[model samples]
Target: MGIIRKTFYTTVLTGASVFGYLGSTTTLISPLPQDDPFWRSRSFARYNVHHNACTQDICVKRIPLDKIRPELLQKEGDLVLEFCRGVWGGLGYKPQRAYLARKYQGPATASQLWTSEQLSKSTYERGTQITDHFEVVEKTPTDIVVRCGDTPRNPNPRDSDGLFVISAEVDKQRNEAVLALKSCFFNSGRKVEGIQGPTPGWMEEAHRWYTRLWMATGAWRVTR
Candidate 1:
């Protein structure tokens, strides 16, 4: 009986120690820039630079806006606003809240901030130091193009030197729209810090996945 009690206590202590270690060292994903408020409070063990490249990932997903006409797609109202809201709100690991700045430099230029809570409870609450800039760089009756600028506060010190465009292509006869998100970026200069992620190949793949996910979410929001 004494031996059994000692073994049980030892096992319990071991389990407790393991759990405590995991709780202390586990790496949680902090909210990305442009996420919602639930993600505002989270911690990141390290910055993951999946793809710090000049290569491009073009994720094109087309949705038929049967109800809306080609002419209406160019205007800022229900369809346009909904699509913008979709881009602002959708696609995050956690629930997100997005805010767009009221002041615009030009007709379609604006800055947006996304804040979200960490999926897991975290003490850190800087809400991913990143800001997104967007612009309606090109607009026509048939096509409207939205450009997303490099997010600030990037963990990877490489810096983004590329173009990211999300364009809406309208088919007048079919009355359908094609949504395309192109992420083109190249890392410029050397790493300021000695730190970097392990796998460069995986980083590019992850980048593609993220951009694709973002495109898919936006497409689903507007079309569905």
Candidate 2:
């Protein structure tokens, strides 16, 4: 089915009427337009400098394993995130802080323990470290959240032990197809994750969608 043709939601969106079972009326509540939690929680920069010297625009990119000078790692104290792709979470984004404590067989003070009870045994084994660390953004100690990063559901090619950013992955992973889809929605004063459009996926797409909406509806537009 075409993307637009695809219903906003499944079953839940479609009301039912049989045996007096009034079409499911359980309303789905997301966040608001102006305060998208996901975007707030996970947002990074992709840098590309095009130097046009009236001659030609040359892109200065740092590539790895290509006669490169040095390999850099993103480190902050006990936290160490390896950068495979030349790009790492730049300055714009901050680490998530909505940490979830793992039910450990070891010490409880162990902050970043991967909860095998929450995740899987293999996932726990592969874990060199675990974290419940996250960032709290907004009023009322409650804000945009990033949960359970000290472990993974499964340490396969996709799942890694580190901060999980939906935006960066969506764009960097491949062509910005999914990201474009998200750009279709994003309303002003819509209260971040409002009970409206925009589903979960990668971050770039999420921001693209948000930025698009912010632009279209003039969310950030200066009105006289």
Candidate 3:
């Protein structure tokens, strides 16, 4: 039984190490206060009624705008859009997009499909489709809100249909731009039951890891 105990302890240590590493690069905000600016933004206003019923996750990192390339600030929306593209370009998101494409018969080239020129010119207009599952719902110079998941075209939609937001706002108080990634899920209008139940703990943890990695990669891309 000594060998069994050793193996058990080893497994626990390894898991803890992995979790610690993942947590190191992440900054998450849960149970966002109702008064948070995000809730008052135009993007959120579109879905304000559903806020209380939604399952939301937010991850944030601040970027010192004064330190980054100055040309990126030439245009009003340039910084936020570049940051959004960076998040989508993250290595960790590639596999997730691939899996979704294969499982849902979505476009095969959904990952990194946007050219630099195309992204630079994009205004993120409402109803614009960003990928097979992601569509623009609202946007401004600082924030872009997207609706993702099964649509009315799908004979059946999953409970995961929801909103994904990427926002970069200059905070005068901190003298930095706050880059945030948020995911919110309520009921899939296409699904009669709405969100069936709470997400599994393992799934939530995995999602947190993915979000952190993606956010970190995006920050690196913008700052580097």
**Among these predicted structures, which one has the highest TM-score?**
3
lDDT of 3 by residue, 1-224 (tens): 99999999999999788668657756787656677776676655554343335566899887787865666667787777777777765665667656654555445434323443444355566666543667777788988888765542442334556668888777778777788888776554432444333456677667777788778767765674
* Cα-based TM-score, every candidate: 0.44, 0.20, 0.72
lDDT of 1 by residue, 72-187 (tens): 46564345334434454566322223333322223333223333322111111123222244334333332234433344323233444444444555656875666655544444
Candidate 3's C-alpha runs over 4 A off are 1-22, 40-52, 103-123, 151-159, 188-197
Overall lDDT per candidate, in order of appearance:
0.42, 0.23, 0.66
Ranking by TM-score: 3, 1, 2
lDDT by residue for model 2 (35-125), tens:
5343343321110011111100111111222221222112221011111110112211212211233233245435443333322221122
- Ordered list by lDDT, greatest first: 3, 1, 2
**Candidate 2 residue runs with Cα over 4 Å from true position:** 1-67, 70-81, 84-125, 133-204, 207-224
Error of 2 at 87 (Å): 7.7
